[model samples]
Target chain A: MPEKVEITPESAVRAVLRDILGLDAEQVAGFDADTELFGALPELDSMAVAGLLTELEDRLDIMIEDDEVDGELFETFGNLVAFAETKAEE
Target chain B: MMLRLEEHNIGAILPDLPGTNESMQPQHAMDLDKWASALLSFSEQAENPTHVASFRGGSLVDHKIELPHWRLSPVKGRSLLRTMMRTRIAADKESGLSTSMSDLMETAHRDVLNLAGNLLNPEMIKQLDSAQPFEFSDTRTVRLESEAKEADAIVNGGPFWLRAEPSDDMDLVTAISNDLIDWVNG
Candidate 1:
């Protein structure tokens, strides 16, 4: 098994949002993990969605199954990071 | 003291991009000239113009079908015209090399067909230009016109290009193509 992840969740969260979401500072800061992701940013279309998933795979080194995604995981910034955390835990 | 979100550069946001040919034996002098002309413009200068010129469709147009020419963006048109002029200049210099109108056409076509890599399909752009009228609006697709009955199927030859990356699926391509065709025909 891999070692536990000790980095600040907040910073990890920030990195994902910045690179994966392609969110600018304002867009990044505007939403916390809990804020709504869908319908909030008009730019977060299917292409953006796919791009973010790829980034998450690269940065976190976690595999997200296609079937694992639904309306919920993408609901808010918080939910996405929480899922990432779970992957780290696993 | 704060950095604005809108101010951030996308190049800074993503990883860097890396860069992209050969000779073909042709039957006639004109064929060879066309091939050389295309290679010069495509490989050397004004790659984008050569792409836009495909919209003009010389030989491919002769076989594929035709659409009433719409004004492409001024930028593309001007750049294409400029590329043509440069090809003429280069042709004048080289004794063995030459270019023809047909060569210009082929290069333009290949440049465009390449968009399939990371984007939506153009469908049968040349054939669908004659679509009677269509009306559509969708995020992923548009509808062009058609004379075919039922209006259920998306025949090729519409006058649009897929400008963005799309998911890899037949259903998605068909849907988007249909939507754009419907919209254009409208």
Candidate 2:
């Protein structure tokens, strides 16, 4: 059996991005607070963002209201992680 | 999955539910009960089905007939509908047409709305909003290791279906097939 590791919001965000974008593990691991996401990555289009947000909600057990989503929230990796952290806490 | 099961001297068959995948029926006219009844008839025509193995949305139909069932990563219909709705909203935004989930749902109620490429009618959408896989004594549920939901067993793998593009995960396939084989022989 795989050992149970506590899933942090940041880790969950990274994993969701990797899974939805079909990126390599190393590529996702390379992401940091400064990494640009929405405009930087071609795969992070509107449709992909929808999938990404839903996957994040599923993985983190958080509900992200539609009104809560904005371009600023997806501007950078750090921004997305912060949003997920806040939602997870609520 | 069928090939692996055959290697173990077990026969397997995957029947496409009516109103989808080359079926003559219109998808907009079908709902959960219709799919369930169609699956029942299809299985009845088969020589003999030892057990029913359903994945995701398929689990919603597997409960109509009495049989030992194995579900892998089964999800609530509302979850699937929500993702599709979000995709629809995104697509509309790309086309310069701003739409919200409530707008899409209101349209769905009055007319057949194509959500994420699926043509869903009012009844279909309404049924999906509350559909859940029925639990019974002979049912076995499996989930990916990353999920928080309870499961009879867990396997390590990503949600391949959620990927932007189609991909293969042989390890996941092997793991699920092994579990099904064990359950069949256990």
Fnat per model, in the order shown:
0.00, 0.43
Per-residue accuracy of model 2 over A1-90 as CA lDDT, tens digit each: 233446889888888888788888798899999999988888788888888877787778777778999999989999999899899889
lDDT of 1 by residue, A1-90 (tens): 111233444545555555444455566767775788778767665445554554455345465654576778878888887888887677
Give the clashing residue pairs of candidate 2, or none: none
Stretches of candidate 2 off by over 4 Å are A1-6
Classified by CAPRI criteria, candidate 2 counts as acceptable
DockQ of each: 0.01, 0.46
Interface RMSD, Å, model 2: 3.2
Residues B71-151, model 2: lDDT tens digits: 998978877888999999898888899898888888888899898999888989999999999998889888877664678
Among the numbered candidates, top lDDT falls to 2
Residue-wise lDDT of candidate 1 within B1-186, one digit each (tens)? 002211331111111111111223222112212432444444344322211111122212211112222211111222223233333424433546554434534554444322113211123222222222211222111122211112233333322222123223455346443433333444
Q: After superposition, how far is residue B94 of candidate 1 from its true place, in Å?
A: 50
Predicted structure with the largest DockQ when compared to the true one: 2
lDDT: worst 10-residue window of model 1 chain B: B12-21
